[model samples]
Target: MKLNKFWATAVMASAAFCGVASAQQGYPKQPIRLVVPYGAGGPTDAVARIVGQAMSTELGTPIIVENKAGGASSIGTNYVVRAQPDGYTLLVVAANLVLNPATGIETPYDALRDLKPIAALANMPILVAVNPKVPAKDLGSLIEWIRAQPESVPYASPGAGTLTQSWGEMLAQKYKLKLTHVPYKGSAEASRAALAGDVPLLFDLGGVTAALIAQGKLQGIVTPGAARAPGLPNLPTARESGFKDVDAESFLGLVGPANLPQDIAAKLNAAANTALKNPRVIESIRSLGLTPTGGTAEAFGSFLSDELKRWTAVAKSTGIRPAQ
Candidate 1:
C-alpha cells in the first residue's frame, strides 16, 4: 500500500508539471484584451489601438482595445489589477498610473506592486501653451507675465490628480508663480477652455494641443520634457528653459497583473517590441505627437519605479493632495 501511494504521488506531480508546461507553451489561446484607462479618442486610447493592432499581428491573436475610463483612471486600472495573472488581460496606461497614486489619489492598486511592466510603448511631452491673449511667446516671457499679473492667472488641466494638473502645480511651485488650477473633465474640455480664453494658461498632452498650436488658437510655450518633442520642434524643453528639474513627460506602456508567468510576459514583450518596429505603427504614433519607445520588460519596470519615486517627491513638494 505504501509503494502504491508513492507511485500515485509521483504521477500527480508529473501531471501538474506537464500542465504548467502546456500552459506556458500554449499561451494566448484566445483574443487578448488591452484595457485603456482613459476615454476613447484620447492619446492613450489611440496608442493602445495602434500598438494593439500591431501586437496582434505579431502574436497571431486578436488584440481588443477596451476603454474603461473614470475615477482618474483608477477604475479601469483596478479592473486590470484584479484580473487573472494570465497574459490575456493586459493594461495600456499612461504615466497617470504612477502619478495618480503619487499625488494622493485613492487608487485600488499599487502600480509598482500590483502590476508587471511588459514594455514601454511611447513617450509624450506635456505641452505648456497659453491662449493667444496671454501675451507670452515663450517660457521666460510667460513666467515674467504671470509674475507681473496683479492676481493669480487661472490655468486649465484635464482634471485633478492627473499629469496635467501635476505639471501645472509643479510649474507654479518651481517658478514661484501664482497660477490657479481649473480642472476639466478631460483634454477636450480643457483644450476648449484654453481656446476660448476661459483660462489664460494651459498644460496638456502635446498630441491634444498640437493642432491648436498650429491653428494659432494656442501658443506653444514650452514642453516639460528632457528634450523637445518631434512634432513641436519649435518649442523649448523645460530643461533647456533653465528648469532642469521640471521633466514631466508622459510615458505610455503595457502591463499585466503582478506575478504574471515569466514565459507569457516574455512572449508579450517580444511581440510588443516586434510591433513597434513596424513603419506604419511608427508613423501613427508620431502623427499623434508621441515618440515610440520599445525596450525590454526589465527596462520598463525600472522606468516605472523611477517615475513613481520622482512623482512622489514632486507631490510632497507641491502640496498636491488627494481629491475629496
Candidate 2:
C-alpha cells in the first residue's frame, strides 16, 4: 500500500509540471482584454486602441479594449491587478497609476507590488499654455502677470491630483505664485475653458494644447521635461526655463497582474517594441502629439519605481490631493 501511494504522488507532480509548461507554450490562446482605467476617447483610451491593434496584429490574436472609468482610475487598475497572471487580462494605464497612491489615498492594490511592467509605450508631454488674452508670452512674463493680479489667478487642469495640477500647485507653493486651481472633468473640458478664457492660465497635456498653440489660440510657454518636446520644439524646457527641481512628465505603459509568467512578459514586450517601430504606429502616436517610447520590461519597471517615488514626494511637499 505504501509503495502504491508513493508512485501516485510522483505521477501527480509530473502531471502538474507538464500542465504549466503546456499553458505557457500556448499562452494567450484566446482574445486578450486590455483594460483602460478611464472613459472612452481620452488619451489613455486612445493609446490602448492604437497599441492594442498593433500588438494584436503582431501576435495574430485579437486584443480588445475595455473602459472601466471610476475611483480616479483605481477601479479598472485594481481589477487588472487582481486578475489572473496568465497574460490574458492586462492594463494600459497612465500617470494616475502612481498619482492615486502618491496623493496618500488608500488604493485597493499596490502598484509596485501588485503589477508587473510590460513596456513603456510613449511620453505624454505636459504643455504650460495660457489663453491668448493673458498678457504673457513665456513663463517669466506669466509670473509677472500673475503677480500683478489683485487676487489668486485661476488655472485649469484636467482634474486634481494630476501631473498638470501638481506642476501648477508646486509652482504656486514654491514660488509664492497666487494661483487658484480650477479642476475640470477631463482634458477636453479644461482646454475648452482655457480657450474661452474662462480660466486665463492652463496646465495641460501637450496633445490637447499643441494644435491650439499652432492656431495661436493659446500662448505656449514651457514644457516641464528634461528636453524640449518633439511636438513643440520651439518651447523651452522647465529646467532650461530656470525652474529648478521640476522634472514633470507623463507617460503611458502596459502592465499585468503580479507574478505574471516571465516568458509571457517577454513575448508581450517584444510585440510592443516591434509595434512601436512600425511607421503607421509611429505616425499615429505622433499625430496625437506624443513621443513613442519602447524599452525593455526591466527598464520600464525601474522607471515606474522612480515615478512613484518622485510623485509621492511631490504630493507630500506640495500637499496635492485628488479632487473630491
Q: Report residue 60 deviation for candidate 2 (angstroms).
A: 1.9
Note the residue pairs that clash in candidate 1. none
Off by over 4 Å in 1: 1-7, 322-324
Model 2, 68-167: lDDT tens per residue? 9988888999999989999999999788888889997789789889999999998988899998888888878888899999999999998988999987
Model 1 lDDT tens row, 138-163: 88899999999999999988777777
Score residue 139 of candidate 1 by CA lDDT. Answer: 89
Best by the lDDT measure: 2
Q: Which 10 residues in a row give candidate 2 its minimum summed lDDT?
A: 225-234
Q: Cα lDDT for residue 235, model 2?
A: 89
How well does candidate 1 score on lDDT at residue 279? 96
